[model samples]
Target: MPADDGERGAAALAQMRAMTADICDVIPLTAEDDFRITTATMMIGNALLVDSRVTDLEYDRTPAHIARGGLDHFHVTLCIEGEMWFSSGRRDVMVRAGDICLLDMGPPNRTVLRGGGGRTHLRAIILQRAMLAPRLAHPDAATAILLPAQHPHARLLANHFAALMLPPAPEAGSAEVTIEAIADIAAAAAGGTADIAAGVERAERHLYLAVIKRRIADNLETDALTVDELCRHFQISRATLYRLFETDGGLAHYVREQRLNLAFRQLISPAARETRLIDMAVNMRFSSDSTFIRAFRRKFGLTPGELRELADRWLRETGAVPAIDTVLHQLARRRKS
Candidate 1:
């Protein structure tokens, strides 16, 4: 949840800039004499909502920010009581009160928020790229798509956000459902959804996929990680399981990839550096040490042993361990390119 910065003038402006420096660059366009910012934030998992009333400012996600590698997310902003100009790629948009706009954080973009008098009310939701990209037919096509308040879906979405933000906030148990509802409405409003029902189903698919992924990670050492067994355990049909992992190629491939990832983490972790490859293979459910080595080499272009040694040298020289997820995400992006 967002907390109050509890400062004013130059102090508040500096605080606001620092708050968002990691994700985007914020430039205060308001005068320093009376610069002001207030916000309440709510987040569940990777779904984040910021209800902000702030002074005029320019928010920029530049090429440098993209290269720094944390832009795998999306933003849907509702202009409750403000005027703004937004641009990304070839499109530009003017957003006013009762209007909504979409921003793909993965791309370089700029938005100027003009509060008319150095104060504006805007609600923005940030979501992971993995969560929203699957729902977009052409992810880049809808950037800066404005959904006016008159649009039926936009009106309904506004109501949902308003209700969730009202007194007596929603419970933690309902966070997944809340995120699902928001995603469905925003995707539909952006013209990326086929229908309301399909949008709802797509959102639900991600919710369930997250749960299943957690289970997979928790039970990585189990023999029941196979497709058939997982289907049985989750009480889902084979086709359902396949569809859930369609983007990942297939259920079997997803599991194998996860196992390999987990194995890599184990090999490079200082605590597990002494763990033998054969034991790690068995723990990761590989049939044999040789099988694990070959698969690992094929996927990462390095044998497990070689990768471990490199990780050690890198840590020794830099005094910092390699972050496997960041490396893997970068590697994945490179392959796609």
Candidate 2:
């Protein structure tokens, strides 16, 4: 659900502008404006809090309340509780209560709202360049595209964002976290490269990527493992593959780290207490013990033998243990230990 007109909606839009370093507008279609465009213009700058913006503009010439402007950020508009028509370049679009529209700020665009003899509320989110640049290298390249509001995940995220925009801000720390997660979710949902997981909760964008990470972790033991192999198996583009791992660390970095974590767990576990380090390396697909030692040292500032010794000491210090404490834990447990 999107916003309904009231002080709450107005305040939320105001707060959004203050918190996010950009401006947002919440407009309600008025009957008097029907058959007459109130305003239409182009937008500029970085807007990411909602959807993509592009450098194009068009209208149906079907007189109505119109909104088009230049914004220094990404602009997202949801035609909640009304009927609306839009033209982006040559493409004409119709928006209903559940249909959300994305406008590129750097491009010229126009929108017309046809009211059903009732007030129509629309929510627009404008995000700054500083806010979106880190997540995407070329954000503008994705501008001027309208993500269908029918997408379940996109609707879920849009609804959540709308809810957040309708309320007063929470405590500062919580609000900050919520805002970042909202941006990440919006970006992921609108990216349109893959499907968002089923049963996704509010503000858990990172959790979706965790699935990809776990997949990589599970396959680390294969001697021929590489990002290309993982990407192929997952059917994701190189950029998406890299983006999924970016928050965890970097893809190559995480692969090496998980491999080392597995090795460390294997070295001290009772099931592998007598397994030769060289053999362990071979089984773990380390091409050479020296290479393994170098990576281990670089990661943990200690040699493999030293880490194993430390793990043994830790195990001895803590008498109780799981059946498969390290590498086995990964295979058997669905969640991180």
Candidate 3:
């Protein structure tokens, strides 16, 4: 049966916490406002399909949380609407509508869904690691990346998730096939073998792109980083480099976005308060302070100074973190609008 926060009224948050305690820790970012969430789960064989619509929320899997919640499965989340920022220690990627991302349950990671709008709808298929591990060439390099939902294999998975919500749902036997297809697509996306032979090639290409991205991040601060340098370093042709980053608006755009994101984080750090804005810009390899400020505002809806002030205010107000039980209990007692 699907558990839901609807009709729980003041008890919604606690109910939500109870429902997901074994999966991940859910924290409402805008605790000052009503936290809304609706979830439906369907079991197919050994896998689970979870469809959820949520407002502003942050899902965290810290070492402490993982100790309490066993991590034995993986979640391949398909974004049906809205966007989320997902970060594993090594990478940060935005998953938006028509995008799919792999979240390794074993890793300590975080996902932030922005608010101030309608709920974000997502379909997460959870399967045990053993289900896909054997098929992967590099299983350890599989998580924290986005795969285009429009791709043939990914499209099949997306279509299946959509069909699961329609009237007169798939039969039990057919549901099993759907589950298999989802697993195959996920495996292929994560550099694993699948029923489709072409998936092997696609998986290798995806893995290659992951390596390229890591290399780019390593040299982001270098002013001379360019497509030519990347090609030489990776021993790949320029065409391959362009194709790999085409979805991100080319390598240059992706690099700039990454640099800007890093600068934004640094600007809000307590220790970075005394650092000059120009110094931050230069460190990111931005040509000038004005250019960096313009790019920052375009990427994050705020100037560096505004973000710093907001972070300071937020830190002062939040002080010490309360226990999860305490927070949920308080939230459960609050009246809902």
Candidate 4:
């Protein structure tokens, strides 16, 4: 804390960001007059103990941040007073007072703190992955595991961090012992939570993606295949669905790619030689025939008509129908030539 009153908040913010540099990038979400933060950080070996209070702020962490920081530790945090909302790539968590949250610092995540104004107190013990990974049952699925306030293992761990946060710190030897005990209790509590919260979530995430994708592939003829419909049908938030296909650009992009691929296959089929272009567009969910032709040309280097004619010529010349994929491959080679 700075001796001058004017430097207090600014100094605190800078110090807090520097103290937790290994975790995430902290950005104050409130106005300067409304923003406030205070923190006490203690380091022992490769572990860190932090007690902090903030009015409101966002914790933004990404895979790139982890790579730059080079120390992605696991944080066992106890929300002593206030609330926290967290969303990692795969899980969303809401933590209330007395709840213990096990946050895997490895992945990309966003967290918002709410205390109604500087009343949110979070006491956390940060342990290096090397120190805790061996003890975890499912280390890969550990982020956003919220253990309720009354959970036995959670209560036990919470009580310890509470005592450690008080004045008159424990002796060096006692602190070392404390770290060992915290690690054991945390791994057990977190491992169990991960099994229920994260393990199933991991499998469920894959299942959800598969189900949503299959739905899109099968329903290209209807306008009901939009994101809004998918969300309502699956009873999932848009955020959850978007995260599922983030790497594929987005839900709309994935849908377009699937539609184009399906159209390509249908165009090459022997029975579809006489299919009308407008019908093909309507069946594939494009807004119009022109829209479908432009997109198909952009993606496959040939319009639907051009592709169909070429396929017909190839079949007539060879006296055999080429595989759908082989036709696409031939077009790609032609494009490069």
Candidate 5:
């Protein structure tokens, strides 16, 4: 349900607003019809995916009742940063942050997201039922109702998704990979085995690595950060550091890629419009502009000027931009799938 600009975009926004309004109303009323569950009393981020709306709904819970929708989308609610009780026809569950529940769209179901002085905030990702139907062919899909709050994969997906939604990007070049892995996890949640692997502890370690990688991105301009230095800063052992970057060709190679990505962003950002190439290279912690140019070309198959020109041309082509973004997002999702 993606649309073009002007009236189409406005109409889409209005539709999403109305859908969220109904969702909010259904969340707190005692599973009844006359409650007129009006007003979202919440915010629905990611509103651009108008065909798909993700909303936050919270209020005092009364008696539980079945909620129905005209739209054919399954609501996969991850108890992200909160507490909730969810029940399908055959399964009832209590969820915390890191936990997830899939509300079956085709069946009668009930859920009460707890919220009060002692209760925490509840958040969930709502997926269109049709968008989810393709993956539900597996018999195990229904059993794979909710991911636990402490499961490593669940935590990883939650943290990565939040970071992608946040301002600063992760420092690691493999962030795209991490994000893909998260999407894969989401897909798996929609269809994989119900029981999480026993290696949840190990997955937790990878989440730590993700946070560390973000820290590295933040310190990209600081030339003094070395393997030993980073180890000391993070209180991680040298062996652990090596393991964290093992999939990315170890610490040095990983760091180089981080620098390169930042350099690429800088080469095209407004900040670099007035800066000299040599100065920009140095500011990105590159040793020399010549080396930077060589590396950039080797990685991107284009010189800085060429790449900038390409980027500018892309900006001028409005129709192509959204297509590119969609392709990139799909590729990222496929990687995890």
Candidate 6:
């Protein structure tokens, strides 16, 4: 049973934004604009089925929003009417009527929805990260990707989610089973095993590693971003943390590399020139400027000043375009290895 808000127009948009923010942080395009919106949501066990119809709008989860707290869930959206475009990191996908899309809420994502002279209607099933963790490997890889409704497993999951949103929804016990089934099907569609017991331990390990890396990236600017703090936050033993990053030259090395890379980006940015090197180092929790510079030079074969000079020369010669795709690809490869 979808619970609809009685408010109309702008008020309805405001209500929708508030309700959505409760589930996950989003900057709703309709929040400040005049838009006709009608929305409803129903909870089935740990899953939330959202039904929405609104004017042209977009929802953005910015880096700042992700720094605050990323959404710990995945959205399986089934387009009922109109179309929507979803973008995250290096992937961009558009889904139309009868199409299905998977969106990982943990990453910075943007969704542009258009009404096409009428309200754009959609049904989205939001699944908690824990629910899908056991069945899928590298679940984040499935994010911002489209699963055409025609695919066998995708069709199955889509039909199941649609059925769950219908009147006289499944009983509590049945809903649990249905939700598990949906996850299993989604896992198979995502190139994971359908059997939960098969490779589940490895899947869980991957999920934990992914979560830890995301947490570390989000808190890189804070002085509290240490291995010990991560252990406490994730309730894992120190040995486990070391084991997780052993292939990446240990946890400390990984964090240092990330911080250095962040600083390198900041150094190359024209707007960041006003930010002092020592201040940036302190913000990144580096003990001192000398230590930070040494680490940065060791990683990139050049000091921060040298890199910034090279960046400026390149920008002057060819404009300020960065090879973003190359960077993303390198990051993806690093994550995989």
Q: What is the lDDT, from 0 to 100, of the residue 102 in candidate 6?
A: 74
The TM-score between candidate 5 and the true structure equals 0.49
* Model 2 misplacement above 4 A: 1-70, 90-92, 133-138, 166-173, 189-337
Model 6 spans > 4 angstroms off: 1-6, 18-34, 167-173, 193-337
lDDT by residue (1-337, candidate 3, tens digit) is 5656643233777787787787678888655247777889888788888898888789887887777756767888899888888887787789888888887777688989974487788889888888866756677777875787566445545655666554422111255655655666677667765444465545435544555565566566785568888777656689988887898898889889888866766765676879999998988988899999999887666678876776676568887333434433443464241
Better of 1 and 3 by lDDT: 1
For model 4, the stretches where C-alpha displacement exceeds 4 angstroms are 1-23, 166-173, 192-337
Is candidate 1 or 6 superior in lDDT? 1
Error of 1 at 44 (Å): 2.5
Q: Order of candidates by TM-score, top first?
A: 1, 3, 6, 4, 5, 2
Cα-based lDDT for every prediction: 0.76, 0.52, 0.71, 0.75, 0.53, 0.70
* Per-residue accuracy of model 2 over 166-239 as CA lDDT, tens digit each: 33321112434544554555555445222322312434544334434545555778744577876665455688
Task: Assess candidate 4 and give its lDDT.
Answer: 0.75
lDDT (Cα) of model 6: 0.70
Task: Give stretches of model 5 more than 4 Å off.
Answer: 1-69, 118-120, 130-144, 164-219, 222-251, 260-337
Q: Which portions of model 3 miss their true places by more than 4 Å? A: 2-10, 19-23, 166-173, 194-337
| Candidate with best TM-score | 1
Model 6 clash pairs are none
* Local lDDT at 154 for model 5: 56
